[model samples]
Target: MPFTIKCPLDNLYGMHVFSRLPLHEAKVRYLVEEKVPSMHAMIELRSGEKVRIHFVHPAPPSPTENDESTERDAELVIVARSVADSDEPVIVTGDLNDVAWSPTTRLFRKISGLLDPRVGRGFYSTFHADYRLLRWPLDHLFHSHHFTLTSITRLPSIGSDHFPLLTRVVFAPSQGQDQEPLRPDGDDRSWAQDIAQSKNANKQDVP
Candidate 1:
């Protein structure tokens, strides 16, 4: 399932598919149809288990423009909520341009009820490869509670500004019940709504 946003949109940042699974067995469907330059893929495995995977490259903050990051975050929350509310498992991975500890990230987790595999683990910062002291975990992989972390590692640099992250997770629906789910409080919901309704919520270029 190759995904490409055509001419009028920035075509440089499209998502490509490279799955080893037999194409005939797995069915792929797109979940997001918004103007935002992001991609969401819902795959039904041969076993009939559904998994939603989203690749996002949200807009980075700029000094000249007002911070629309909140709006972008809100849009992502909406997408995540849709998936989380379903029985299918979800995994969202991308360069959010925000730290794991940031308020936006927390709100995302709360609204989506997704688990951060790095919660008890160490920070796997991927940005500013050359700067030792100014790095934070900008690239992230958030999953539903139905999955368990098998291993997560920050791969060596491929001459990019950010290092790649490699994670191995297994779907175990039985273990989901044991995991504590994150829920959004009233204030968080209100904040998300406000952001989503902002006048500057027009589509912007995603990194």
Candidate 2:
């Protein structure tokens, strides 16, 4: 007997998958190219509120000598710019392969205007399941100001390198007005653009 995996919700609602890289069946079996893959979706809630969700698994830091900018950082710059250009609420979640307090993540927050729930909270490390002290927070869930955290938990591991993050947020557009979004200064904007257009930046064909 043979079996196939499917997403019931996506199948029922006809959700589309968008990516910069081709699927596994395409010429590229995996993301061996410079660019990593980003999957995004626009979802409508029962209250008719539209939200954009972006998932990314960016490349980790390599030993190769490159510029100050990294592919992961460049991809983040792209995500930030896209979020800044959109009016709808957005949530970016994934194994970013970087720490929550790193310069890249801070720059990302500034450029995207997205908030991390972990602010004022503890560092919920998610990686290195095998070692106790070697763990660090790698997986993340960032949301726009339109939402507030109702609950967040670091779920038990199911035999993976990283632990799963479970977060519940309540949509409150009114709250967004009170929440001050992070804005990038002139220097910050220049840095982001430099990273995005860096010579070694990933140049995948994303639609």
Best by lDDT: 2
Per-residue lDDT of candidate 2, residues 134-196 (tens digit): 999988999998899898888898898788788888889787667766678999998988887
Quantify all predictions' global Cα lDDT against the true fold: 0.68, 0.70
- Worst lDDT run of 10 residues, candidate 2, spans 24-33
Give candidate 1's error at residue 35 in angstroms. 7.4
- Candidate 2 regions exceeding 4 Å error are 1-35, 63-69, 199-207
- The per-candidate count of clashes, in order, stands at 0, 0
Measured by TM-score, the strongest candidate is 1
lDDT value for candidate 1? Answer: 0.68
Distance from true location, Cα of 76 in model 2, Å: 0.5
Error of 2 at 159 (Å): 0.3
Candidate 1 positional error at 70, Å = 3.1
Per-residue error (Å), model 2, residue 187: 1.0
Q: List, residue by residue over 74-148, the lDDT tens digit for candidate 1.
A: 556665556556666888888887899988888888877888899888999999888889988999998887899
